[model samples]
Structure formats: structure tokens, C-alpha cells
Target: MTTPLPVFAEPWPEGVTHRYLTHVGATVDVTGGGDRTGYRCTGCIYGSSGQYWHENVAHERAQAHAEKCLALPRPTQ
Candidate 1:
């Protein structure tokens, strides 16, 4: 499997813009290894390329994002 791309902030190309995309659990058809199959995936890519953009292009943005994410509320059991 290919490693998923990391999110970062930078000046998006001319075509890129920020927006939120909804994600929900659903069955998806996928073909792989010469076989057609379906499976479930976790999480959702809700934001558009614009939403993924970062104010700072420097790699430091990763750390900032991490901290921000950590501050978010966690689900209660």
C-alpha cells in the first residue's frame, strides 16, 4: 500500500481552494490485486485542498497541527 500523503499548509496552486467535504461510513467498491471487492474505510477527508492549506509553508506546521488536534475533545466511553 502507498503511504497516505501528509497535510500541510502552503500557497495552493491556482486551481486549489479551501472547502469542507462531508464524510460518512459507507460501503465502497474497490478492485485490487486483480480482484474486485468492497471494504470499509476509516475517517473522512472532509476538507478540500484549500482547507488543507497551511499559513506557514515551513515543516513546523506539522507540529502546530498536531498540537491543535491534540487539544480537540475526545469521545467519552
Candidate 2:
């Protein structure tokens, strides 16, 4: 029999609570204030999208985008 993969656990952010996972697939949902921010791989094998299971190439791409966004100077609000 094949062994089940291990799950990834990240520290819950402050003021943010509640997490759910399922055995049918390898996705984890994190919710706060009725808003579904995004999903993370329970197994850390897939990127933000499960389409790239076992590969975090998409995650890296997302990280690059986020970095660019952060690097951009913000306008006074």
C-alpha cells in the first residue's frame, strides 16, 4: 500500500482563524471574515493551483508577481 503524503502547517496569522482540509484531494482552505483569501497545498506539492501538483512553478510565478507589486511605489491613499 502507498503511504499518504504529509501535510504542511503554517502558523495561523493573527486575527485569522479556521482551516479545513479534505482527504479526497490535497487542498487546504483558509477563511476569515467570510472572505476566502486563497487555498494552499496541504501537501505543499502543488502551487496555488492544483494543476501543477508536485511542482511549485506556479507558486514561484505568483511570488514574482507579488514581489513586483510590493516593489512598486504606492501612491498616497
Candidate 3:
């Protein structure tokens, strides 16, 4: 068995969340800090750019894209 990713344990604006889904794969932790207060994902669209949004839009974007990716047809072996 594999260990799960660390989830946000604090309140909003200081929260971080992550998970690995089929077709969507794994994602780096989405977090923020001083002057960089926002969210980011390495396996998402921004992809390591560390693009931070003012709100939790980062999670929405990543989730939306992942859902679409998961819905895609899987290639046969």
C-alpha cells in the first residue's frame, strides 16, 4: 500500500490538498506562503509554473482538468 498525500490541516487561504486519480495521475502539493499566498499544482495546467491565484481557483482548475482527463477513453493494451 502507498501512503496518501498530506491534506490541508488549516483554515482557508492556508490550506493545501492533493490526490492521485485514474488518468489524472499524481499531483504535487498545492500551497502558498508570504508574497506567494495562493495555490499551485505540478501536474496541472500551470505545471510547475507555481502560478498562484488569489483564491482556491487553483484547486478548481486542477479538479476540472482531472475530471476531463479521467473521462477520456483509455488506450487498449
Pick the lDDT winner.
Answer: 3
Writing each residue's lDDT as its tens digit, candidate 2 over 1-77 gives: 96684355646545333343334323333333322233343334322442322224333443344332312222225
TM-score of each: 0.19, 0.25, 0.38
Quantify all predictions' global Cα lDDT against the true fold: 0.25, 0.37, 0.45
Ranking by TM-score: 3, 2, 1
Off by over 4 Å in 3: 1-16, 20-24, 33-48, 70-77
TM-score top scorer? 3
Candidate 3: tens digits of C-alpha lDDT, residues 18-66: 5324344434345553344444343444333655664356555555555
Q: For candidate 3, report its TM-score.
A: 0.38
Clashing residue pairs in candidate 3 are none
- With candidate 2 superimposed using the best TM-score fit, by how many Å does residue 6's alpha carbon deviate from the native? 12
Which 10-residue window of candidate 3 scores lowest in summed lDDT?
A: 68-77
How many backbone overlaps does candidate 3 show? 0
lDDT comparison, 1 vs 2, better candidate? 2
Q: List pairs with backbone clashes in candidate 1.
A: 9-54, 17-50, 18-50, 18-51, 21-46
